[model samples]
Target: MGCPLVSIIVPVYNAERFLNETLNSIKSQTYNNLEVLVINDSSSDNSVEIIEKFVKSDFRFRYFYNTTNQGVSHSTNVGLSQCKGEYITFHDHDDVMLPSKISSCVEILENNTELDGVITIAEYISEDGSPLGTKTALPDYITNNPFFVRAFERSYIPTWAMFMRRDIINKLEFDDNIKIGNQDADFFLRLLYRRPQLYYLSNPQNRFRQVSKSLSKKSTSTCEIYKKHNDVDIAKLYTQAGYSKVVIDYALAKANLWRENIESALNYIISAHERISEFDEEEKDNVYFIYATCLYLNQLFEPCLEILQKIEGKSFRAETLNNQGVCWAIFGDLTKARDYFESALSILPEYIDPKNNLFALNASESMPVRHFTKFPLRSVYKTI
Candidate 1:
């Protein structure tokens, strides 16, 4: 089989530390016939030096530097415009693509010409390259039809793991206005209207280092999530762009997610009890606690107690007991509340929640003396 022409874009900022490893990994890829483009987004560090070294040593590597430090989106767009290959993918300065990453993605694009792009799960790693074990599973595609839009949301997919046709790249430009992040997500979401099928690697296909200064840490919440807080507008974007069903599905899913957040943060029992079935069974402690606490707050005592009883471990290991105390205290039953609070304290002695509940249950306005100094209160006369 003839090898496909692939363009790999690497946007450099201050990537002096990990850039070499990333380049080496790419060069070592089993697949050849590759054009590697490095866009030096005006680095004041050794990134340009490293790029120069790579370009000087290899004919396949080409690089350009920006006069000023435009954000990543701008740099990516520049590289996108310059890519002459049939298939394209971009990598951040610090992240590493597996040796098989490009070849594997390219093959998928070739075989599935209908795909706008291919994506895969990224194995999250620390600076030291130890796996953090965070992964998004992609079971739906292999078992079900993947050439549709909604199938993409099974997990978080990023640009590094994706290879798109140059035609798709030509039609879309990275939105540079988002200084911190998420322009790619928005652009990709817009494309889902066409029901572009996306293929992901069977496993995490790259190593994504969790650096302190990555776009995630620097970006606004909206940018980090790559979703607008107001979905109606985003839905409108998808609707106008062509994928009306995706908009609807996103709206429904978003509503459920928000409901989860609210359920997780609930402080009232009665209100919470009404939403019990909404809680996913595998939610973390915070999620369950929020739901149960809300149920207690709403005065749905029996159901609240029942759910509270089911909770086993969490930051709120004491939540069931503490909130039970609330139910008792509100019903003119201070004794029962105190007992429940004490039970909570027994389960987690260091936690302040149960302790605070105890103080409130006892009608003691004075909170614990958080700091204490102890000297011999009385002078020791002699060894006794």
Candidate 2:
């Protein structure tokens, strides 16, 4: 019945610039019962000195150092092994939590006995801590049981925005083998499989610092690394949980398509289409859109048009029409492309891509149709 202790595990690696601000945010939390575990991952900078300062000032602050530079996963696992709180959470060294973050999450979990974890919205901030924007860990449509599918589609859940019961934390381990990225998604998928009742807190109480040199900001090669290392393991995990392989294939296909790996995307798309019965109408249309876009990208204009025709729903009509316009533009049929773009604009009058395509077609001499042809269709699809 007393205020349960919360363990905040932060992994630091040469984060000397932001370490003071980050620790100060935690130290100023509204909730008093907290054990701050700052895992020093062989930081060569004055990160250790800063952490030692905090330890000297605060009785609740704990610091542990790794012998060598292991990654975030390993450092976090070390913190996990050492934490002795009833509830557990994670903090990134560069990010800062609002004062109310701990109190809000702790109150929710304590009151809702059925909930295993709670997630809050993240406000993205620049290096100087200026506000960029806000993002939710899960979309409006995703809740509780559908978290696995949503996490597979996109790993939007920020680690710093989550608070979990210690038992739930004990049930999962961060996969150290996932070196490149998306280790959180892999761990979260496994956790969701256990059917833990999860809750979403929409308040923007977590400030996520978006640094240009972060791993996610790296080149497309990092994405390829994630696909190679973690995608297969995630797919296998979903399969073992009795979910259809088609779902996994669909998500993988989208990821490959996003990475512009046309051939791999096509393979997964084909596999998903072969088991089309596994998806509902809306999901099927989404798959159709991806399939059609792939065909159009490969310059298979006629077949791409054929696949787009099979899309039955109104949900993706504007996107379908815009892609149809792109296909026509690439095939050098400017007049037909203009028509499709106009039709798409009729559906969604402010649709940017189609509007731009229409402008390009009409002003052909100023902006040659060939220019649109060379433009990557994947970029256009991303806007939708």
Candidate 3:
């Protein structure tokens, strides 16, 4: 059989600044049998012009423009409808695919007929293409297990790094209603529900650009609303899939925590704790961490530390230590807080939460007590 054709769908908005680089990355893909679809969602910038130029220059490049400003999901759906290849993938207009991205994934999927899709790691890049860090779609343990647990807890495979068969793509559609992000997670969970064989490549072949204007960075109420909506749907799906209720509760608790709905978060964490027998040691530790986080948020510092004391594992030691520092900071024990933050940093030097907390703590000590009150525990604490 010949190499299957791959269709790369890119959703563009006001991405004129980096659109050319993104297009050039796709053009340079080692995989030659590919069609590039740039769907412009009524961009106010020169995005459409750049896309048109690429289309004119490359026969494999196709351009589509929305009449009105639709969201990324809508633009992606439109591109999905236009794709004519056997295998498919997606890209963001502001990101660039490594030259080997398409070929690497294509080879894996082509070799493994059972796999419905293949996912690769992504390298986080700054606006100017400088390296920020790297992230994997799934954690090491979850990746080794290759089970529903990974899908339930963190189904955050970036669209840019995923390659799916057209048949799978035909069976799925991005929920345009999920306006506040997590659309990719929701889609991934639904797709994984079908129990399709999947593979993960640890090689970082996609450069995910992190910008202040990205949907994830938006903290508006509208974004929160959509995030909660999507989270509710995902939670329900997980419950229906007959996964452990503790995991489900933990997921809901984390979602509520993100929305700052302390009451709901507390309730979910309580449920997870009450059914602690249903979880493994690692999961139980995670539950304890979340429970402590909820307690810390509610200003129950002593009880938060109590829960942290119950947690027993190195898996979440850094985060748990960071939370302990936050609790100590709130209890007017800056010395203890500093010690905890230092301990957390010793555990994970690259962990940003403890570093931020340490910085905030030092700032508070240098400033007047009244001025320090402005930097509340909430501001210093990272979410679970």
Candidate 4:
């Protein structure tokens, strides 16, 4: 037996500009046993001609075109319906996959039996493949942990960076409703909420092209329409992913729903009422910390103190002490806040949040500070 068969689905629409580079990247992957499916989703440009060119030139590629314009999810489902490989991955037409991408994913997935999927860090680049400073965390979006270095929250998780077992997605399909933006987020969140075994490679394997015209990257009015649709999927994901703490999830979900409801920054304060009753001491304290911060940011310190009081003098942990101190400082209790902050600082020097929050609190306190964990996080993936 040779290498396992892998199927790569490329959904195309008005991608004539970068289609060749994307296709060429797949063709040149170090892993040779693969099928490339290029679904031309009713392109209005020369994309059809470009697909035709690849069809003739590369025997490894097969081309399909829809008579009408279906969205990327539709095209993706069409490609998936045609897959016969043991493993499958999606490659966006405008992105580039490094030579190691396929081989490395193939290597890892073939060995790890429990992982439902793998994610990788990817770069933001202009149309010509020049890098932009924007970076995202793939593990954050993939894993269940928030505030962890799993995936970055600032940007989107590119569709091209995941390697998934075809069977895990068996009978599962992308929601066509999220047509314009965050299609990958919808898909991955569903996978994680339903299946808990997903892990990440932690390095960039795909170059996510941020061609200015890309709908997901736009800031115009049309993008607002796109964002509402994206939030729908996120809210759906939150229904289950937020089960552990509805209050925390509600705060995060509202933050996620920011575009649709412009006053979300205030709604987080309202979470105190929406939160489930009868929380344990720890649970209530955690919820209060998130609540106090939201109130402080929205300049509602009176309520912030109401929550902060519950956590103060409770003697939880160093981190908790620090958070309570910050809230008190915001509530104008400079003396009390400094005591808690100093005590927390003495207990845990490595916890940076207290240090930063305390410095911001006083604009006058001094402390020696260094942040690391012996080995800094260098790559999400270990090298060969």
RMSD for each model, in Å, please?
12.6, 6.2, 5.5, 10.2
Better of 1 and 2 by lDDT: 2
What TM-scores do the predictions have?
0.64, 0.71, 0.78, 0.62
What lDDT is reached at residue 156 by model 1? 27
By descending TM-score, how would the candidates be arranged? 3, 2, 1, 4
Model 3, runs deviating above 4 Å: 136-149, 178-180, 219-268, 274-280, 297-299, 341-384
- lDDT of every predicted structure (CA atoms): 0.62, 0.74, 0.73, 0.64
Index of the highest-lDDT prediction: 2
Over 1-384, each residue of candidate 4 has an lDDT whose tens digit, in order, gives 348899999999998889888888888899999889999888999998888887898777888889998788889998889988888899888888888888887777777767666767677788888897445343333354342211212233456766778788877777676566667765654554354455566677888887778856633232243354353454455444443445444445334333434346346435544653745554455455555555655556577657666654243456556655665665567678778778877977666766676676556543322111111112222110
Question: What would the per-residue lDDT of candidate 1 be over residues 124-174, giving only the tens digit for each residue?
Answer: 999988888756454524211223333222222456766777776566766
Which predicted model would earn the best TM-score? 3
Model 3: per-residue lDDT, tens digit, 1-384?
368899999988899899999999999998899998889888898887898889999999998988988787788888889999999999988888899988888877777777788777789999888999887344321122235434444334557767889887675888787653666766765676565566767778888899878765643342243253455675666666565667778778776776677888899989988999887776677677778778767777799889887877876677777777777777788899889889988988987778778777777774321111111121111112
User: Which stretches of candidate 2 lie above 4 Å from their native place?
Assistant: 136-142, 219-285, 294-301, 305-384
| Candidate 4 vs. true structure, TM-score | 0.62
* Candidate 2 residue 38 C-alpha distance from true site, Å: 0.8
